[model samples]
Target: MAEKKYKKIVLAYSGGLDTSVLIPWLKETYGCEVIAVSGDVGQGTELDGLEEKALKTGASKLYIEDLKKEFVEEYIIPTVKAGAAYENYLLGTSFARPLIAKRIVEIAKKEGADAICHGCTGKGNDQVRFELAIKAFAPQMDVIAPWRFWELNSREKEIAYAEAHNIPLKITKETNYSKDKNLWHLSHEGLDLEDPANEAPVNKPGFLELGVSPEQAPDQPAYVTIHFEKGVPTSVNGEAMDCETVIQTLNKLGGENGCGLLDVVENRLVGMKSRGVYETPGGTILYKAHEKLEEITLDKETQHYKQQLALKFAELVYNGQWYTPLRKAMSAFVDSTQETVTGDVKLKLYKGNIIPASVTSPYSLYSSEMATFDEDDCYEQGDSAGFISLFGLPIKVRAMNDEALAEKTGTHFPSVE
Candidate 1:
C-alpha cells in the first residue's frame, strides 16, 4: 500500500497480545518510533512490569500515568449522578475508554508524535469509543487502528505472529479470553463466550478473581453505610476519605461479600450482540446507595424527570460522546438536581444482594407527619374523597360510559369478580 504519513506514533498500549503485536506491526509497516502509554486506572497487578514488557516489545519509551483519582472523581462520579447505566449495564468499560484515549492524546502531544494507535478490533464498540475520543480531544491527530488495517484477522493469527516475532506475551492459546480491568470493574469476553448456547458454570474457578462465589459468600449479612455530598460519595460507614480510597475500600468489601457480578448478552453499538461477564462490586453498591439517598432527598417531579435524563446521558457515554456539548449540558442538569442529594444510606449486603436498609438526607423531602397513617395535624382524612375523585376522573368516565352502553344493549359488562 501507500506509505504512512507519520514518523512517530503513540500507542494506547495495554501490554496485551493485540497491543504487543501492534507495536511491532506499526514499526514494520510505517517505520515509526512507537511510544507506548498505559493509563493506570487501578488495574492493580496488571500494571506490574508493564514498562519492561512494553519496551521489550519494541517501544522506544513507555509512559504509565496514574489516573485513578481523576477517573473516579471526574468520570465515574458524574455518570453515577446522572444514573447512566446503558441497557442495565453500569457503563464500566464504556466510561474508561475516554479517559484512556485522553491520556493517549496527551502523551502523543508531549512526545511530539503525529499519530495515535490502539488495538481495538474493527467489529468492537471500543474502536468507535477510542476513535471518537481521539476525534473529540485532538481532531487533527492521525489514529492508527491496527486491527482494521492488518491482514491478520483472528487471535490465532495474532498469537502465531507474536510467536514468530518472539514477542513475549502473558496470554496463551489455552486461555485467550480478552479482559479489561480497572477500579470500577473487570470485564470478560471472547473465547467460549461467543456461543449463546454454552452454559456458563455457576462456580467457575480462576475466571472470577474479583468476587466471591455466591455459594462461598458469608452466611451472616454484612452492613455498611455510604455517605454522599451532593451526589458524590465521600465516605464508607463513618470514615471520611478521598475518592480513590473510597473506591478501593468499597471494591474490597463488596468483592468479599459477592455484591456485584453480572453476566449479560448486550447489543453493541456496531450492530452485533456480544456476551460479557462483568464484576463491578464497588460500582454496584455505590449505585444502590446513591439511588436510595436520592429517593428521600429529591421531590417526586424532579426525581422522575432526572430518571428520563439518565437514559439519554447513558446513551451519550456508551456512544463515546463524553466531550460533546450535550453531555456537558446534561451534566449541569444532573449537578443541579444533586444539590440536595447529600445523605447517608445504610445497606445490608448478604451474599450477592445489596439491600438498602435506611436512608437519611439533610434535604429529605420525606415528612413523617404528612406520610404517617396515624392521626396527624398536617393532614385531614376528609380531603381524600375530593382528591381521589379528581385523580380517577378519566378512569371513572371510561367506566361509566362502558356501563351505560352495556345497559342500553341489555348486556352485562365483565365484572372484576
Candidate 2:
C-alpha cells in the first residue's frame, strides 16, 4: 500500500523506545512535520526531560499536558461506577487509550494536520483501541499505524534503526519489558512474562514498587473508612479531597498494606492469550468499599440485575466501545441506580486482604423494625407460610401430576411413556 500523503501529522509520543523512533520514522516516510503530544496521566518519572527529547529527535513541537485529574474524574470514575472489570481485572490500560486518543485528535485539528500517528504494535489491543477511538472522535483524520506498515518486526530491529540514526533511547535490550503505567494501575508484559510457565521474579525490587510483598506486610492491620456520594468516592477517613487526591491517597495506603497485585493469563480482544502482572492497590480497595456500600443501599432485585449488566459493561469497555450507543445506555442505567448509592464503608486491610468492617447508607432498604428477629408490632411470622405455599405452587402441582401418572401406569412418571 502506498503511504498516505500529509504536510503535517500529530503523533502520540510517550518518550519511550517505540515512540521515540516513531517521531523520525513518520517524518521520513511521509515527509511531514511531526508534532508530538504526550498526555501526563501520572506516569511519574517517565515524563522527565520528555520535551527536550522529542525536539532532539526531529519533532516540530511537543505538548505535554497534565491529564491526571481528567483521567481519574472522567474515565476511571465512570468505569468504577459501571463495575467494568474484564475477567476480574480492572480495565486500567483499556480505558486510558481513548482519553489519550481524544487529545491527539484535538491537537491534530489545531495544527491543521492531515493525519495522526501512533506507536502501538500491530498485535496488541492498544492499536485497535487507539485507532478506533481516533475514528470515533475524528472520523476525517487519517490514522498512521507505524508497526502495521513498517518492515521492521522486532524490538531489536527498532533499536538498530534508532542507533543507525543516532536516536537517543532510554530502554536497553536487557530490560525491554513493555510497561504501561497510570495512576490507576501498572502493567508489565514481555520478557519472562511472555512465557506462561516462567514464574514472576517477585523478589526483584524493580518488580514490586506499588506494594511490599504479602510476607512483608505489617502484622498489625490498618483500617480505612471511605465515604461515597452517588457511587463516587468523595472522602477518605472523613477528609474531603479531589478525585486525584483520593486515588493517590488510597494508592499509598493500599500499597503499604499490600492490597492489589494480580497475575493472570487473560484473553486479549485480538484473539490471543497473554500473561500480565498488574498492581492496582487503590483500585482494589475502592472496588470493595463501593460494592459493600451498594449492598446496604440497593434492593435485592436491582442489585442482582446490576450484577448481570456489569458483565456486559466490562465487555464493552474492554473491547474499546466506550463511545458506542450501548455503552452510553449502560452508563445511563448505572447512573440511575447510583442515585441511591450514598453510603460509608469501613474496611480492614491486612496482608493483602480487604475485609469489610461495616457499611451504612442513608438510603438503606434494611428496616430494623422489619428485619429484626426480636418480636415487635410489625411481626409477620404467619405470613411466611402462605407466601411459601404460593411461591411453590408450580413445583407442588408438577409433583402431584407425576404421582398420579406413576400410579396409573405402575412406572416412575419421569422414566416412563
Model number with the top TM-score: 2
Residue pairs that clash (backbone atoms under 3 angstroms), model 2? none
Q: What would the per-residue lDDT of candidate 1 be over residues 173-291, giving only the tens digit for each residue?
A: 98898999998998889888778688654377888778886677899988989999999999998999887788778888898888888888988998989898888888999889999
Model 1 ranges with Cα > 4 A deviation: 1-5, 395-417
TM-score of every model?
A: 0.94, 0.95
lDDT of 2 by residue, 124-201 (tens): 889888888888989977888878878767899998889988988877898788889889898888889999899877
RMSD (CA, Å), candidate 1 to true, equals 2.4
Candidate 2: C-alpha lDDT: 0.88
